[model samples]
Target: MNLVSKNWEYLKIVTDIPKDYWSTKNEVVLEKENLKLRRFKNKSKSSNNAVLILPPQAGHSSNICDYAPDQSLVRLLLSYGLQVYATDWQSARLNQADLSIEDHINLTDDAVEKIREETGLDSITLIGQCQGGWQASVYTSLYQDKISKLVVAASPIDFYAERDFMNDYVDDYPMEFFEWLVKLGGGVMKGDFILKGFKSYDPYQHYIKKYQDLWKMILEDDKEGIERYKRFYNWYEYTQDLPGKFYLEVVEKIFKKNGMINPGTIVINNTSVDLSNITCPLFLLAGEKDNITPPRQCLEMANHVGTPKENIVQVTTKGGHIGTLTGSSALKKHWPKVVEFIENYSQTA
Candidate 1:
């Protein structure tokens, strides 16, 4: 009876989703036996900048949507005949809990190299978002000649800024706090941890929004609102747990101690990864309303790149962290500039 009831409810939810809720599918290219990349195609002109995109902390899979960066950036770039391919992140469980940040770096860098080798080009541009930005910056610092241009969107550069609340919230949470959390999560990161990141502003707003949306779904028999909620549930729930060793290193060294900002504080692959190595032209996009990672945090990125600060351009839009990529404002104002920035840098670099 319980199973039947659940099936009935799920069927009802599916029936309620609106006809226009779905977007176009992106081409999933099998880059490797273990890795699949999302290639956003644009047939027009050709440029030297073959973009090899990196995903967030989620780890490595190009499962990007056509409507989002995959489509939007692809369409825009295609007009100029530029090619774009995004790297998708995989889950820790499937890959085993063996990867560290260094492993992630190797995966990304190797992909960039392979793409260039296949394309018969000497270099490519790097577009990094969120944690991907941190990865890009680190890569630029280390492999300076590989990337001709760097575009970091909605990514936090300065951990010292009051951007990530978890940084401060966990600050004094006794070292035992992590131990308790690890046990509670049963040795893996849970959906709750990821969802909590969206609650720093008026913690109740999310719950209230969910409550209102559910009511709207029921009252109007709105299938779209229902399906959107369901898809969001899937993504929000699908979180990869960080390795205990990596988590300890990230929180203690990167977030709390600001090891990333401090030149000599961190080391990867036996080599010191420092921001000072990023001497190439850089473009930084920061959402003004982003509560998760503030603009102030992103503002400091230009200072470290070995290039003149004048080469760094910051476009501060008024959307939230994720909204900057998905919402209307980004399409109208932000993305155009990003495309142009890449175009100009591509020709000149």
Candidate 2:
């Protein structure tokens, strides 16, 4: 191809990225206004232990848990002789913008109950990723009896654990600034705007460096590399809107107030969320290089949880935020160990 043709192809590839879809097959066992409970279809029946995965709800689809055939967390759990289910959070519309953190917790509780009913288990293991990690922590705290084990991957339990970029960003801005952004979105926080802020954290990588790499791939006619790029961007580019109320609450109660680690700081349905209430076997996963949620943010959970020191396990992967959950090396090396921890606990439960 000529230079002009190649340039056009590059522009078209970036501009018209393909839509994202879930690679794994799942059936929606339960549906609510804010989320759906999906049970993954797998042939393996090695164990009947049910696991509920809570994917990050920060303006992205829950499909991140089942990103692709090989990179899927759900599939990995299925392979380990465990039944897996996940929460698919819906993007907030104007009507849904009144939902709050308490509402999400309630919805999550409902999902958990549904899983219990289907599996006929009194409790199941809970796994939360990214934002979902903290959410899972809160749920486990409040509903401790319903959880056999808790695993949080790249989740921030203590926002003040480290002086990271996200803490700086939240601290530097006034509350009104974020409130105004939500106002502009008509009570919904636009996912595209959240994505922009994330990209801005590493502008060179998101803007110039990636395109430069893509141009080089085009010049070399690296079909495989280009295809890989397309698949990743398809998932990355799609955004989901969050309720303005929920966003503000996350900023104030979770981030600014550092509520998860502190008891009585976050209250839901008249019940205060106390991290120490979580007495189940706990597994905390952190990405060694994850700047978004620093390792300290995740590892600090060990200090606050009621789980005995011997029952708590922490693993740090050599990848970044999203990579910790879906990267090839993390999936191969770190996640299997996490699964093993869950399996060991499941056998006893």
Compare the candidates by TM-score and give the number of the best one: 2
Per-residue lDDT over 1-349 for candidate 2, one digit per residue giving the tens place of the 0 to 100 score: 7865775576566546435467788999998987889998879778867899999988888898988888889889999889899999988879999899999999999999998998899999999999999999999999999999999999989899886889999999988999999999999999999999999999999999999998888778777777778878877888999999999999988998999987888999999999989899999999999999999999999999888888888899989998998888999999998888887854234
> In order, what lDDT does every prediction score?
0.65, 0.89
| TM-scores for all predictions | 0.82, 0.95
- Model 2 gets an lDDT of 0.89
Q: How do the residues 65-125 of candidate 1 rate in per-residue lDDT, one tens digit apiece? A: 2343333545555566667777666444523444566776777777787777667777778
> How many residue pairs of model 2 clash at the backbone?
0
